[model samples]
Target: MERFQRLDAVAVPIARPNVDTDQITPARFLHKPRSDDHGNYLFHDVRRRPDGTPDPGFVMNRPEYAGAQVIVAERNFACGSSRENAVWALYDHGFRAAIAPSFGDIFAANGLKNGLLPVRLPEDVVAGLIAALEAEPGARVQVDLEAQTVTLPDGSVHPFEIDPFSRHCLLNGVDELDYTGTLAPQIDAFMNRYGRENR
Candidate 1:
């Protein structure tokens, strides 16, 4: 996973609430292997019209929000199903972080494991950010994981909290399994000492 110490990129706003995993990546597309570009299926059903063409009405389809690396969303974002594919779709689609009033528990966990930061803030604060992004479609928001703060387009900075271990892993570019592997020397030493003492 790539390190996520800081990000300064365009943020796309999704004003809807309860955007479930199914919407993020339709279940039918889940059969594709991870090696495939899952980003192509991100919001597949919603991003396209019934005729199969890209929907110009969707926020993500807007030309200005192209290549946005951040998502500002309403409450209960990514709710429903414990599919890690939801995180994959977001990360694969170039989003490194998401800011919202709240998020589905499993989605948040999956995000940390995949190098995507899920930031929780007050409802009003998130609303303000979403409003700002909607008003200025191509505006950039700054995220500093080391500082645990997000700088809005209006130049206002808001603090957020994250699990200490998650923060450490993100800053160091290691997943939980990679982090555990780093403790091999200590684990070996402890095992050797225990064997000698017990013998």
Candidate 2:
């Protein structure tokens, strides 16, 4: 997992609500192995036209939002299904953070484990962000995990909260297994003490 300390990068606005896991990455593409670059399949169906050509009108297809690392979106982003692939698709597609009013519980969890930062803010705040991104295409936003704050394009800062453990893990670029590995010495000592007492 990648460490997320501070990010200052281009942002893309996705104004719709209730964007589901299937919409992020269609179920048909699930058969592909994890080694494959899922980036190509991110928003696979919606970003294309009925004839399977790239839809120029889609925000992602537009040149201005190209290489956007942050997504400012409406409420309930990634709301359907418990598929972890949704997070994978977003991460592989180069998105490091998603800002919204709310997120699906499972998707948020998956995002943290996979190194995608999911930010929850007031609806009005998110709307403001979306408006700014739209008004000025290719605008950049800042996310500082250490401060738990997001800086908008116009220089306003909004704070957010995350589970302490998740924040710690993300800051250090460690997964659950990697964190547990750090406690090996303590675990060994406890096991030795228990064996002596039992015997």
Candidate 3:
């Protein structure tokens, strides 16, 4: 997991709500070998037309938003069954943070575990940010995880909320289990001291 102290990147605005996991990465691609580059299948269904050509209508297909690292969306983003792979596909596609009004609980968790910052701001704030990014696709937004703020194009700032521990993990580039693994030495010491006495 990469540390996410702060990021300044061009933003891609996907102005839809309730974008579920299936839409993010269709179920068919779920069983593919992990080494097969899941990023290729990110938003496969939405990004491709029926005849297999790329959908030019999708926000990501636009050339201006190419190499954008931030995703701004509407309410209830990534609402679907708990599949960590959805987060993987987005991460593999180089999205470091997602800003929205709300997100599916499980998806948010998955995102944090994978070092993706899910910023939850108020509805109006998100709407304004998305509107600005959509209108100015070449513009960049600054996301400061340490400050818990999103700096918009107009030089204004909006604050967002995140779990403190999750923020710590992201800043330190550690996953949940990786954090626990850091305590191994203490665990070994405790076991050696207590086990000898118990015997």
Candidate 4:
């Protein structure tokens, strides 16, 4: 997982609500392998047409929003059945964070565990941010994970909260195993003591 401290990119807006995991990556593609190439399949259904040509109408296909690293969205982003692949698709697509008013609890957890940051702000605040991104999709926005702040193109800032454990893990580039590895010594010592007592 990438250790994310700061990111600057053109933020893209998905102004609709209740964007589910299937929409992020269609169910038909679930059999595919996980790799950097997964990005090509992100939002497959919406990003492509029936003939498999890129849908030029989708925000992702628009020239200005190409390679966007952040998604500014409406409420209930990532709402649907729990699927870690959804997070994988987004990460592989190069989006490191999503700013929305709310998220599906399971999707948020899956995303955070995979080093994707999900930011929650008031509905009104998110709406304003979406408007800005829509008005100028190529304008850069700064996401400072260490500061827990998002700096808009015009220089305004909005703070967001993250779980302390998640923040710690992201800052250090440690996933669940890496975190458990930090306690290896303690676990070994406790096991040694148990062996001594049992003997």
Candidate 2, pairs of clashing residues: none
- Candidate 2 ranges with C-alpha deviation above 4 Å: 181-199
The TM-score measured for candidate 1 stands at: 0.90
For residues 50-120, write the lDDT of model 1, one tens digit per residue: 99999999999999999899998999999998988888889999999999999999999999989999999
Question: How close is every model to the real structure, measured as TM-score?
Answer: 0.90, 0.90, 0.89, 0.88
Give the Cα lDDT of each candidate: 0.94, 0.94, 0.90, 0.89
1-199, model 4: which lDDT tens digit per residue? 7798899988899989999998987887787887547787789889999999998989888899988999888999999978788888999989999989999999999988888999998999889888888897788889888999999888999999999889988988888887688899999999999999998
User: Where does candidate 3 have its weakest 10-residue lDDT segment?
Assistant: 30-39
- Output the lDDT of residue 37, model 3: 76
Candidate 1, backbone clash total:
0
Better of 1 and 4 by lDDT: 1
RMSD (Å) of each candidate, 1 decimal = 3.7, 3.7, 3.7, 3.7
1-199: candidate 2 lDDT, tens digit per residue: 8999999999999989999999999999888889989998899998999899999888988788989999878999999899888888999999999999999999999999999999999999999999999999999999999999999999999999999999999999988997698999999999999999998
